[model samples]
Target: LPPTGPVRPDSYDFSFDSYFSGIGGSGFFLGDPKLLAPASTAPTGAPFGARIASAVENAREGIADHIRSSIGGSEGEIAAALIVGVRAGIPEAINESMRRTGIYHIISISGLHMALVAGTIMFLLRGAFALFPDFSSRRPVKKYAAAIALASIAAYLVISGIVVAAERSFIMLAVMLVAVLFDRAALTMRNLAISAIAVILVSPHEVVGPSFQMSFAATAALVGAYAGFADYRAGKTTAPPVKRSFLKFLSRKLAVGVGGAAVTSLIAGSATLLFAIWHFQRVSPLSLLANLAVMPIVSLIVMPFAVLSALAMPFGFDGPFLYVMGKGLTAMIAISAWISDRSPVDAVGLISIQSVLLATIALVIA
Candidate 1:
């Protein structure tokens, strides 16, 4: 271990007990650093997981190089971050700007990314099956497609370095897949509850982490909102037969897109606001604005292009897709930066311990 360097009031005192308890670390070492000779060999044998990780890392590096060559600057870094969850190339200024604007989650490996990948796969597979009468009519192509989507999500989670939030999302996706296999509703409060329970059982410590808390909070809020308005949705579906022209249809779709974006941002932002203030002590006043501007581009263009590029790389046809992906990422970065620049500075401060406790209780109850 590196030197502790003048222990302060909050300095972590290392010990064997702490290590065993998972408090500090496993051990400490003190030695003069020396460089190894070029001819010296180290461990190179990789297990299945190691091999998978190596492949993922190599692909990320290759894609990063391609992105850099196509579109330099923070855009390449943003593309790599969005595609593979590799943010090492991202500049500190961009990171700071994202955090300030509350749009950093876009680049993080979370439910958004998982949902995009799964939804895309399921849609494409179902569409292909629809085109083939034999599969759609005689076989259970939807369930099989969902299973394949689950597998793809698993691969993505692992390659992106599975963390607590990703694990929860995967569990939810898995539960949904199982539901589809059994011909049950996929999106329900029960699925979210099961996923939360599983995540807590696997890593109870994650309950206190922002990723776990914010994710469940957002999902729960959405679930409750949908449940609350189920009757309205059911009623509306029975009387929605107003035929329109192509131009009118296009206008309606654009309106729905804007409205849906606003509502989603509102729900998610409201759910995570207190948690953000409690954990990071900062609230991005422009979070909804930033998300509204960036999410459409990310989901519709950046992520799809990146995923296609990734799939095409093995066939040496990824350059065009990556170039388009970089363009989308560039626009996204500019939007986020602009929003961040206009947002106010200074972190939101909790008034007292009582307020914090109250907020925590409210979140838990919700």
Candidate 2:
């Protein structure tokens, strides 16, 4: 292979001979790789999928370049990772800190990112529709907003390079949005199951991968926990409360928000515990504290600015938004580093297959 040509990833068709690794005593190795043919130069030669992928790659590069030019430095790199799913420029030290503190998913395009994007779009669209009383009174504005949000997420999925985690998140979110269109419950176990089935059908091998297992586990646990909470609340009846002072009301709302974030961190961490041990052989004991400290910045400031900056990019108004977003990113990184420094050393020894299976079974049952 030469470096001079316009060679796409899928441009070359190659064949290789496989052999057992003599020294490693595990896995096979490829040898004597041969290039069979280059991609066709004809207008209609490339496969549709390949062409779409190429365009996506180009878009990702363009986005990355724009982010770098606007933000610069590691913040720009993090922005690129968060928005376009490109992390090649992020320093390894920062990545290690995030991984140790268990906030690495902030940089990874996953369910949280998808949810934020969809939720923001839905919120804005619904609010806009609500301003028109006549229209809102007569039409199913929620369904229209959901439909548009779905389309936005589909575009986001393509922009993010359609990785396994992003794909799974998109499927789950798309199902929820579709449920809204049909006036059905969106976050039920049935919808989760449907999303899981869809992902497995598309990439069955991913079921055994860490991204698939950890993602689904966390989602299942969160859904089950919230569903149980909803049921419990439904069963309990309370008299109407007396009105409180505005300060008291605000404090109570803040408390509830913090409590919810804490509960979410605990649930997701517990659900992914076994998978983390099995795949990475480490656990962040301070992850709950880290999430509590940093998630507000991410959820409230970083992601919102990310969305705003993206929307404003075409009009050359993203500079200020990106600057504000960078501040939030800086705070998040600092918090993660602080937490990582205090985190306990990695847990020793590998967990056995039986233990992993048992934990997985227990998770499923729960």
- Which candidate leads the pack in lDDT? 2
- Tell me the tens digit of each residue's lDDT in model 1 across 1-366: 432432433222334224323554335459986768532222377587766666766765666677676667888887766666677878998888888888889878788888888888888889889999976899999898989999989988876766556777888778888888899888798888888888888877667666787888888888777776786787774765799999999999999999888898999899888777766667998888889898999889988887777778779888898889888888887887888889998476544547767986886676
Measured with C-alpha atoms, the lDDT of residue 184 in candidate 1 is 89
Q: What would the TM-score be for candidate 2 when compared with the true structure?
A: 0.87
Candidate models: Cα lDDT each: 0.78, 0.85
Clashes of each: 0, 0
- List clashing residue pairs in candidate 2: none
- After TM-score superposition, what is the CA distance of residue 256 in candidate 2 from its true location, in Å? 0.5
